[model samples]
Target: MRAIQITEFGGPEVLQVSDVPEPVAGDGQVLIKVDRAGINYADTHQVENSYLSKTELPLIPGGEVVGHTEDGRRVVALVGSGGYAEQAVAHAPYAWDVPEGVTDGQALALVLQGTTAWHLLKTSTHLQPGESVLVHAGAGGVGSLAVQLAKLWGAGRVIATASTEEKRKQVLDLGADAAIDGTPEGLKDRILEANGGKPVDIVLEMVGGRTFDESFAALGRFGRLVTFGAASRQSAAPIDSSRLMKGSKTIAGFWLADCFANPQLLGGPLTELFDLTAGGKLRPIVGGEYALSDVASAHEDLRARRTVGKLLLDPTR
Candidate 1:
């Protein structure tokens, strides 16, 4: 079998396409003949050894797979590794059936980013309907889904921030009430102005550094902010406890790995996402596709921010 192996972590150049024996399913695991895999920002961090968790050497770096099993179940599953290969393995509980109409790429998107977005809203924040909401990186994988799902779940006003006009427009088309520039300068002002000159009730923040500070500052009294990523690869300074205490503001952090540890909590949202995709209500924006041999190029594009939405690799191509 062919897999993208990272013998040592550094850059995209280290991701080598090489032959390795296919992984077998363990006693409680399921073997999947991987058709496509999703390339994620976390994959980049794993390669650099800067991820929140450590990754072993000689790793096959992919997080999710959309493929088949011996019984012919077309499923989307979360794999810890070996997704960037001809075959991968997943635990049975984490492997979910892709609905009849949801395409493979869409299903693959749901396994990681989609589920993260879902849990951010449903489990972590418990967002209330009719509250104003702002989502950073609204054009990317999780942000795209967050924007749409926020509106679907009944946000009174949905605001999205993007680095490019095209991306801002992309989120608007997906149901954002307004879109704003996500630049570090005057970002809070822009978000405040976009929300009709007031602070927002909810914020979906993933970018760290100045962006995190601005998003936290843009929250209204009793506002909730969920931090999911640091795509900038930088951390924000510690929040002033006094300020949060004074304003009744709350900040929460979520890691997808935690969700993986508790699969019992995912049954509802995963089923709904598949149903929504099958019904054409929720959509995963797939932006780029690469052959398995070109995994390094995919990583290069991702690290360089040269692509948008969900990117995929066709292991069988």
Candidate 2:
């Protein structure tokens, strides 16, 4: 089996395609012949050892995979690691059958990114009907899905922030009521303006530092902001408890890993997401597909913000 291996923690440069032994299944796991591997921004942090969890050395950097089991059942799975390979092991409980009408890319999208978006709104924020939502990085994998889900769940308005004009248009096409420049300059004002000169009810914030600060500031009374990632790798100032109390604001943090302990967290929403894709109600945007050997280039593109939507790696290549 060939896999992307990193012996040291650094950047994309550390990733290398190497012929590695096939991973064997454990008691509660199943062996999978990987067809596609999903590339996420978190994978970039994994390679750099900056993720929420620790990264062990000599690692194979992938957690989401779409593949076939030994019994020939096609499934999309969330693996602990080793997904960027010709073969990998998946926990049986974590793998879900791919519905007939869904493509591999769509199934891949539902694994880590889709579930994160689902939980962010349904779990972390407990989004209410007619509530306004602000989705940062609306052109990225999770952001793209978050935008659509928010609309489908009957949000009053969905305001997205993207880095470029083209991406902003894409966000709008995904059903955002408004799309604004993601640059820090005038972000708070732009968000307010897009929301009819009022603060948003909920914000899906990933970019840290000033972006987080501004998003927090733009929240209305009883507003909720869910922070999942710090793509900017910058830290925001500590929140003042007094300010939170004054506005009745809530700041919540979410990580997809936490959902693994409860099967319903990943399985239930994933089934819904798959059904939505199959029924033509939801669309998974695949930004680009790369050969397994080209994994490093994929990381570079994602980190550079040169790609939109979900990215995939064809392990067979």
Candidate 3:
């Protein structure tokens, strides 16, 4: 089996395709013939050993894969690793049947990034109807979905932040009420202006550092800011308890891996996301697709903010 492997932690340059032995399925696990594997921004961090979770050496990069099982059942599975390969092992419980009318890339999108967007709104923020929501990196995979989901859930306003004008337009197409510049400079003011000179009721913040700071400052009373990723690779300032008390604000952290402990958390929302996609209510944007051997280029494009929506790798290529 050919797979992308990393023996050292650094950047996309560390990813190298090698003809490695195929992974074997363990107890309660099944072997998957990899068709498509989802590439996330977190995968970029994983390669550099800077993600929320630790990255072990001699590791394969991807965590979510859409493929067929030994029994010929098409499924999308959230594996620990080894998804950047011709074949991989999938834990049975973590795998779900890819419903009819859903493509492989769409199924892969719903597994990690899609579920993250869902949980960030439904579970972490406990978003309320008619609440104004701000989504950072609005053209990216999770942000694109979050914008649509916020609208579908009856949000009063959906303001998005994107790096480029084209990306902003894409965000708007995804149903954001407004799309603003993502740069930290004057970001708070832009967010407020977009929301009718008022602070947002909910924020889906992932970019850390100044982006996080600006988003936090734009939150209204009783606002919730959910931090799921730090794409900027910079830490935000320490939160002040007194300040939080003053505004009744909340700073919540969410990692999709945590949902693995409770199956319902991942499974339930995934079912909903799948149904929405099948019914044509939810659209998953596939920004780019690369061959398995081009995994390094995929990571590079993601880290450089040169891509949008979901990215995938075709193992058969």
lDDT string, candidate 1, 6-99, tens digits: 8898988898888999798898899999888999988899999999999889798998899999799998888888899989998899888888
Q: List the residue pairs that clash in candidate 3.
A: none
The global C-alpha lDDT for each of the candidates, from Candidate 1 onward, is 0.88, 0.93, 0.91
Off by over 4 Å in 3: none
Location of the lowest summed lDDT over 10 successive residues in candidate 2: 11-20
Highest lDDT: which candidate?
Answer: 2
lDDT of 3 by residue, 191-262 (tens): 999999999999999999999999999999999999998988899998879979989999999999998987
lDDT of candidate 3 at residue 178, scale 0 to 100: 97
Report the number of backbone clashes for model 2: 0
